[model samples]
Target: MATTAQPVAAREAVFVARALCKTYRMGEVDVAALRDVNLMLHEREFVVLLGPSGSGKSTLLNILGGLDVATSGALHYRDHDLVAADDAALTLYRRQHVGFVFQFYNLLPSLTAYENVALIAEIAHDPMPPAEALARVGLEARSGHFPSQMSGGEQQRVAIARAIAKRPDVLLCDEPTGALDAATGVRVLDVLETVNRELGTTTLVITHNADIARMAHRSLHMADGRIARELVNSERVPALALSW
Candidate 1:
């Protein structure tokens, strides 16, 4: 019964999408991945998108993160027009403002944790020290360890550290816990929660897990190709207390 109401003043909007659409071309036909979707993401808000497979959750997240473009619609990240941005502009936007975490921990096998994270920091305009980023994820001791030497959850934490070292304005995660066991997933989720709360990074997560929604400030349920419902959590459930 909680509405999208808060006692505090309204936060500034970071992303605004109006009448968004994305269509995929098959060998012989066109498939609509998204249909006239509308949404707004506020600064420092933790938002979750939930849906079954093929419901367009990933498509929407990809579009927002600049991994893909919408077929048509008004999509803006602050003052930048996402829908109108060229490949170079979109790439720049992602590098300068967005951090991405995927289901798989895409850590380079040859690199140590610190080195993997330093790869991003080296190119970032203003980045946190790789050691500091590792410490933020509770992996300071594992900084010299390679991916193969770490557990799945640890590797994922390293991935998260690499993403955030750039101090991005927004963090987008796609099924970040999908490949891990329940306990490991919880640990990863806690790291994400800590990052969002401590750094005030505007965060968005895509997941099929309903329990994860309880941790979000707001949840968007998707069906077919659009948002079916939106809920504002009256109270957030801590990541440690969430069950599958």
Candidate 2:
């Protein structure tokens, strides 16, 4: 069965960042995580943020997901200004618009895959049924299994299912495959690609692996907390097509 495409525009900006800066204080020392970052993420775009450790890729994702507030910058997600948002507004924004996947699966060990996914749907405003979400990640048959009963790749797929089940407008993934071996990592990435293509979630993946950049519609390289370069892939490769 063919999947429908995501709409290109939604009559408003999905993300807008200007002169964004993020700084952290460790005792008397200050660390600049992001500096003078400017970016615009649109609906349904599959973007990859690539950089080494301390390059600020994860910081950018956190700021976008509303998990962390920028120290100095202007960020607008649709009509909501993230910099000006209160804790309650940020919570609602995260609940209603953002879905997150981290390097760790973070699934409950005792809950079956279906139950783990259902937990998110239960709290979501308008979520897809748990079984349907599992099917989307090619995990329907594994729904009955617990996290310990599944392979790392399978567990990550379940995580992906849980994130997408909320029908979020933006999906933020930080080193999503970082814990898996290369082979398993590829499988997890395949699921993420499928989610982006099939569901049209505006997906942003943060990775240090340059190989994964080929799978993105657009790739942004970060350095010293700023976007060093941005490239549009004329021919994007699906994750399944990647070797290594």
Candidate 3:
């Protein structure tokens, strides 16, 4: 029964949305992906959007991460108006402030872990060294290893390292552990939790697993293209304590 209560001075909100709507145009039909959604993501908070498949969780995450734009509504990332931003602005916003991790590892087949992370750092406004990023994810010794040589969890860790090397303000993870088993997924979640704790990145995770909600500072449930309810975990548990 945890409420959304915390230290007012330190709890700064990052993304705020009101009456958000997103629609997709088919060949001859319009499909509503998200409908009048409202949400707020706070600084340094670990939040979870939990929902069944096709419940608009991914759509909402994409919009927040700037991968997609809402059809209509007020969506703001701090002072930036996300709903009014152009393509160039959105691209720049993502590069400078947001980092993303997906279910699939999506690592470059031909590159080693170090190289994959360094490629992003090369283009970032300000970035940490690839080796340092690797170390943060506990993969320093495997920096030289190629993606094909790594396990699923190791590959996901590498992906997390690449995402955080640029030191983004927000980290958006879309089912980051979907491809791993329980043990492997826990390792990946451990890395994510560590990053949120040590770096103060506002983190949002999209998942169907209810057990994972126990690890979040606040869990928002989505249903039928809208936010159903939210629960704040005043005393959050570790990922290792969760079961399928």
Candidate 4:
């Protein structure tokens, strides 16, 4: 339960994927979700993965989050080999190192925003106070409200708060703003940007919206289960500067 911030060294990669593959078996046929993918995410970097539907973005995110195991090849997070990790080790890694946010706001309907965030913090080995985490997402005033009482954007902010409350080393977001309208999505993205900048957490956001690439430190384009291109922004724009 060490809360001290560790300086991210320059030597080793945080994530290392080499010829990773994942296939799903549906009855008599096999559906290949990911094919020979190799990628790395460094510490404190904001990376956006852009891809159309059925392009294996979610599959890659799942594999990185330890929610699903790769079928072949090597997947390593720091010194730990993720592809060979057992269930217990995976659970430990997720609990200690990773945070996840999804498209839908999965907050419990009965719990207030503060309580919902506190639930996760209570279980985390080293967590920030729920109030401080909620404030980071611009939800300090709405802390007592339930998900039903909040707008879509506000609910999403609460979800972000919950994800970051653990002060995780890595944050994995899959279509975090998919359910919100343009204006609201921008606001949600603002909070995400703030989290990335202030906390120095290594963030990977997967979205189909091409405009989002403007805000990332590096943008990754995925096609047919492989990375098609990678671009580093010379001067990354803030989320508020993004146009549809």
Candidate 5:
């Protein structure tokens, strides 16, 4: 199977990984989560990772987001050497350049949607206004609503708004729609698609659903800690038109 593929038009490579490996020590046993993973993510590209549970999808995303470190090989985001970066450097890297969204919406129950996004914007070096962020996700009207007041999909959009509020260079999402139903999931995917298209934020999404890959510019399939195949879509299907 082909392990590497490029986008149609040449773009600046945002992430370059060569022989990247990640291992976790569990008691006396070492378990490899990623093995010799070589990949290049281009600027403003939307890539989907399809794999089963424990297929190193989240591990690779974490490494890219600076939440975890690789055991071996070189990983670079632009000119930043992620493998050689220290804890402080990694922290700065994440703060300045990366935005992350997990399966769960980590919004505070006590805060409204606007407040939740404003919290992140307040600390960022440069950020869009909280209102603007919520508007991007189509939640400007719901800004005053709390998590309990919104549906699952609405909450997820708010989470996305918070991530993008910082205007980070990259957005890393691990199963962003995993918790929602099919219809609601489509709505969340639409927001991600819109963000990637409009903001030109380089996006990587980890999803178990194969249907989600159809909306991406490129799809990567992983198995047993290695990327097994790569597929490039010449034409992208809109997220709303995708059959869930």
Candidate 6:
């Protein structure tokens, strides 16, 4: 992917969603998860999505990462139409291009850190060595440790290494620090910031913590399944400096 800042047009954006809609039907009623959502994520940019519970932040992230299809309107990954993609196409797109980290560490309990990360690298089209990826998150010494043997922050860092081992074009993180304490959460955020800055990966992070917004280039606020507002930081505060 081009690291230099090019003009981000609709066709040129890493991800684009225009008038996107998603609704889930229960036995008798339908719940609208997203409503005419419009969004664009530029290549190599770090953006944070802030919202209350059930504000559709996770839904939007899932759609952007090809993990779920939109109900209606245009959702594009570069020139490809995500809304029109079949399950196979979406799977292919996710496997080949996107990296994901979620709230839980989700590491394989039976595997050591190295093995857990190496599993993805083995299948990636272009992958950094698993060891190198681990080291990127400051986990070189913990390569032999299993998730159960590490602290919460360490496990989260290992999970991050596994996600980025594929050297994906985009990293979609949903509440990556939600499971950790404040100090540990800052550590995870630091690793995320490092990945974005060093590897030039476009990152979209979803978090309920409003204080986390200061670390992002642009903060998007979601409410009732729509993006209610956006705030750009004049100067991004380091994760360690965050009050929360």
Q: How many clashing pairs per prediction, in order? A: 0, 0, 0, 0, 0, 0
Candidate 3, 92-166: lDDT as tens digits = 999999999999989998999999999999989999899999999999999999999999999999999999999
What is the TM-score of candidate 4?
0.94
lDDT of each residue in 1-244, candidate 4, tens digit only: 1122233336356899999999999999999888999898888888899998998999999999999999998999999899999999999999998999999989999999999999999989999999999999988999999999999999999999999999998999999999999999999998888998899888999999989988887788988888888887766788987768
Per-residue lDDT tens digits for candidate 2, residues 1-244, read 2223334445345799999999999899999999999998887788899988989998899999999999998999989999999999999999999999999999999999999999999999999999999999899999999999999889999999999999999999999989999988988898888887778788999988888888877789999999999987767777877766
Candidate 5 regions with alpha-carbon error over 4 angstroms: 1-9
Go through the candidates in order and give each one's C-alpha lDDT: 0.93, 0.90, 0.92, 0.90, 0.94, 0.90
Model 2 clash pairs are none
Write the residue-wise lDDT of candidate 1 on 17-94 in tens digits: 999999999998999999999999998899999999999999999999999999999999999999999999999999
User: TM-score of each candidate?
Assistant: 0.96, 0.94, 0.96, 0.94, 0.96, 0.95
After superposition on all C-alphas, the RMSD of every candidate to the true structure, in Å, is: 2.3, 2.9, 2.3, 4.8, 3.4, 3.5
> CA shift at 34, candidate 3, in angstroms?
0.6
Q: Once superposed on the true structure, which residue ranges of model 4 sit more than 4 Å away at CA?
A: 1-12
Q: lDDT (0-100) at residue 116 of candidate 5?
A: 98
Looking at model 5, which ten-residue stretch has the lowest summed lDDT? 1-10
lDDT of 2: 0.90
> For model 6, how does the per-residue alpha-carbon lDDT over 160-199 read when each residue is reduced to its tens digit?
9999999998999999999999999998998998998899
Better of 1 and 3 by TM-score: 1
Tell me how far the alpha carbon of residue 3 in candidate 2 is from the true structure, in angstroms, after superposition: 16
How well does model 3 score by local distance difference test? 0.92
